[model samples]
Target: MEDGDLLSRALDFYGLPKKFDANLVRSRFRELSRKYHPDSGEYETDILFKELVQLRDVLLSSLQNDPFAILENSKEDPEGFQFYKSAKQKAAQAIEKYFQFTDGNPVYLKKEDNPALLRLRQELETAKNGLEEFLEKFPKSIWKEDTETTLKKISVWFKD
Candidate 1:
């Protein structure tokens, strides 16, 4: 395929705009590779492009999987808020339940001790992580303040 076609395909895989600055990609990637790569300059353009694709994948995934991004994306209307708000709330509740069930317990413990509770805790942590990330990207999201407030409750654990 042509370079443009390949670039477009890469963009599509990462859910990015097809039209990006070619020179910027060249420069940014060159800089990034220098930092990330052990033997940087020896790589080919195809390799560079592959790295670019990987970068795009990471950035896109981070944003897409981000709960804040989800909220921001859905902010065009009221109904969008309903789904995001519910998810944010659910995540908060799950985290709370997780904390309650695991109160004063060792963090390194295995899930087999209480399989159902452990599973619930895992899900709750996952939801909270997603919500936290989502809130970061969509600070002005409909349920953002509530999400932040909920996040603060969880934050206390790591402090002590």
Candidate 2:
């Protein structure tokens, strides 16, 4: 699945001057770690402090490198706009039948009445309601105006 807004948003996330790609992200994180290292002698920084800070930056960059990183970045980026857009397009295709609804929807309830079904149902309801609430509370979400439309519909389908 490919998102229309992913490249733009990922670029912004890494504070890159240009568009996002695999190599630039690695370079950016490396630059950040190098500049902020405690051994740079710019300040009296502690080893633990530098390590912790740099570790987080490295991990975040690693997420970007992963093929699934775009999905991970979407949650933290904004209203999950880019992620949802790509997902919607993929879900609409007939070839995606092998992939389950990873968003944790309650579609399985129609097939069985097991305890797991109830739990998933609850989760699906929560995600849906949360999206609805988020949209109402945070109008005009960052980066996109219609961010709530798709999510709201997804959520409504889970209403119980």
Candidate 3:
């Protein structure tokens, strides 16, 4: 089976959003695992348990390489901390657009080098530039590390 297919199936099985963090995946898996575990005397124990493990592994692995996963817990805005938030949000939206096209599985998009992918890359670059602008404007901002980390994460996609 294709990785995307597996990922989609995993997402469906876990009842998770396309954009999820490792903690969410793990927590959900554990919740389901408790119910489906063979030791719990659930029906179709072996197959269901195995499938859950596989899907959990797939999601966890995919998230590790997922550039946009950085955005999952990045809404840490305090009062008057909107500096460059729009730029970060722009990059996030660009990522979401790509994921939307690919049904949340980047593997599908990575296989094709069409105009859509090119545009996505361009959009990502623009977002990166925005983040750079933020950094330039606020060199001593409290969010400097986060801004830099976000820039580096977005750059990861271009490397591929």
Candidate 4:
């Protein structure tokens, strides 16, 4: 196959466009990896698997070197991009509130469900849910990594 054809095929395998989309690529990789991992008992040593790895590597390299490319591609899907951006902002605000409530200290011990704590928890949950919704709506969002990072921080705070 021609180089361009191979690239196109690779992108198709991951359900991505010619332009890079880190979030969608990673999400699809995770799904396929789970199914084809050596320990998954369904490993395939065919060209398809090789193509998957090549596409993943190319996308990952692009992400590391020029992450802004993903943002450029987002212009093609403005509505979804806008939703992702808005949801991410909302989540960030909620996370800030959470930190304020805890006074920047780690709540090592789980406290009783007091009214204030309950209210704070609700706010955090709302933010997390919003981010989750964005992920569902725009699996290929350029802000996916940021969203996931924020979610992880929220999870850590909840453990307090």
TM-scores for every candidate against the unseen true structure: 0.34, 0.30, 0.49, 0.41
- Give the best candidate by TM-score: 3
Looking at candidate 1, the ten consecutive residues that score lowest on lDDT are 15-24
Query: What is candidate 4's lDDT per residue for 58-137, written digit by digit as tens?
Result: 66665544333455346677546655564555556666766687786654435474335566666667667767776776
Instruction: Mark the regions of model 1 whose C-alpha exceeds 4 Å error after superposition.
Output: 1-72, 78-80, 92-114, 154-160
Count of steric clashes across candidates, in order: 2, 0, 0, 0
Candidate 4 — which pairs collide?
A: none
- Candidate 1 structure quality by residue, lDDT tens digits, 1-160: 7644654665654445533333334555556666555465555445655666576554444433444534444534543454455456566666567668779675543445545465565555665676666665556767777776766765543332
- What is candidate 2's local distance difference test score? 0.46
For each candidate, what is the lDDT? 0.55, 0.46, 0.74, 0.65
Ranking by lDDT: 3, 4, 1, 2
Best by lDDT: 3
Task: Tell me the TM-score of model 3.
Answer: 0.49
Residue 142: error of model 4 in Å? Answer: 1.6
Tens digits of per-residue lDDT for model 3, 72-99: 2355533214546656777888889877
